[model samples]
Target: MSNDRVLNICFHGVGEPQRELEPGEDVYWVTADRFAAILDEVSTWPVPVRLSFDDGNASDVEIGLPALVERGLTAEFFLLAGRLDTPGSVDSAGVAKLRSAGMPIGSHGMAHRSWRGLSAAETTAEFDTARTVLAEAAGAPITTAACPLGRYDRRVLSALRDRGYTRIYTSDRRPARSGAWLQPRYSVRHHDTPASMRSGVLAPAPLPARARALAVGTVKRWR
Candidate 1:
């Protein structure tokens, strides 16, 4: 990756266990701790981009936190207010620990629902409630949010900006450019292997054949 191609890496649903809700069905779950190990490796790249984990799951505190601590790295965790079981979710104490360790907790909206079909009042309520819950839990205001499922329209951005959210993120299958409340993010999948990760996140350079190889080698190490 060149100096300009540093990708902003973020993980979704870390350490948040998923159950099939029915027997004989497949299930998917990624633990925060296991994902943190991945972050540790990716974060060592020459250009350090922002690292973030989505959804306020118990595993975030259990598995993901320790890895960040070990690597001396900090991340922003987004919370879904209504879906969060207050006690099991990152509670006041858990947020305190994250803050003490230099991590910031953020909001992921209420109920992980899309704001595309909602009215203005409904949109405000969704943003406000999640911010309230996470703010109370973290003892600090949350000014950033990642749209659940990356679904949004003009109204969504307007509501967030009106509510004073300066940074808004989306998992909209594209690379992020510094923009006004419409930052794009690449969602790292559970099935991604080391080789796939390098190709997806690293950008190719415009150097000679040998120089390109060197750039890719150096960038791969960071991945």
Candidate 2:
């Protein structure tokens, strides 16, 4: 509950996916009722909480947006440039709608591939082209990104920084410094419930545990 720290929660698909899910992707898709309940829980947290949705799922605008609006909450949505307009995913119109609704849109890259160790051409496609496509769709500058699959390395981080991304989110499941350029987030998954989230995320970690988590993040940054 320290003012210097913030809880960043991330969501993927909600309910049934309209299009075919990637292998192991179903684990991140939560039931509609579960999503609502989790939102309710987070809304009441005493500490600062930031919300974000990834993968450009159609459910983002369909189900997620309305629920967030009902609670007077807004979340950042990361869009996949390549997946736009495809079945079950948020299209260009949906991206525009989110922007109009006061939701910030960030690039989730051209494809949903990991950002770690990408070749030069792949990096250009993922970072430059995807940001261009999403900015056009959102009608605003896209200055933030969520690493695809929450995978990144030192090189990936450096590339994003050099590309002028103001913020980059990762699914590291740890509380993050509020002003950190590279923010870590706890991703809500299929089996996560309000109780589990409160105990696992909201509760303060012991000093030793916090150190271990920090160490893990350091290792990831350099490995």
Candidate 3:
């Protein structure tokens, strides 16, 4: 990887779900063993890798945190403010614990709804109030976010920018620019293995594939 490039790896639930999952959400949940192997593989990468956990699943604290700690790695945990304290999700105490363990806390919005074309009120609740709720639980300012369900459009991006989020993460499945405000991430899924991750993420993309990825991101931003 080039010095200016960085790989963003995102995880969702690890192991079994404690609560009911949304439709099609099971694809993002990986087994504990798979999660561990992937972490170990990424730790040996020759390039810069930024790690993050999304959806605020309880496993993030129960399983994910320990694996990361054991590997002497830290990640950003994006908490869903509305889901805090809900069964099967990370609660307020879990959020605090993640922060205390040196993991940065970020807002994953109030609910795990798509941030595509929200109304005015919905936008305020998801973008503004969600950050407030998460910051209070984390006991720190929340200045970053990962789009729910990897969905976003021009309006959504504009709202996040106007809110002054220092970094915005998306499941765009491409490498990211080191200092860019909008970061694209490859989310680990149930079928992904260490080798698949290495070949898919660690290996450099072909020039045509790279161009296609960039075009996709550009379309999402402006469409």
Q: List, in order, the clash count of every candidate structure.
A: 5, 0, 0
Task: Sum up the clashes in candidate 2.
Answer: 0
lDDT of each: 0.67, 0.91, 0.90
Structure candidate 3, residue pairs in collision:
none
lDDT of 2 by residue, 1-223 (tens): 4557889999999998999999999999999999999999988876679999999999999999999999999999999999999999998888878988899999999999998878899999999999998998888999999999999999999999999999999999999999999899999999999999988888764445445667777524321
TM per candidate comes to 0.79, 0.91, 0.90
Clashing pairs in 2: none
Which digits, one per residue and each the tens of the lDDT, describe model 1 over residues 141-194? 889988876788887888788889989888765555544456776666766544
Q: Across residues 1-223, which tens digit of lDDT does each residue of candidate 3 receive? A: 4558889999999998999889999999999999999999888765679999999999999999889888899999999999999999998888878988999999999988999888899999999999999888988999999999999988889889999999999999999999999999999999999999978887764445445767777524321
Candidate 1 local accuracy as lDDT?
0.67
- For model 1, give the 10-residue run with minimal summed lDDT: 19-28
The local lDDT score (0 to 100) that residue 3 gets in candidate 1 is 38
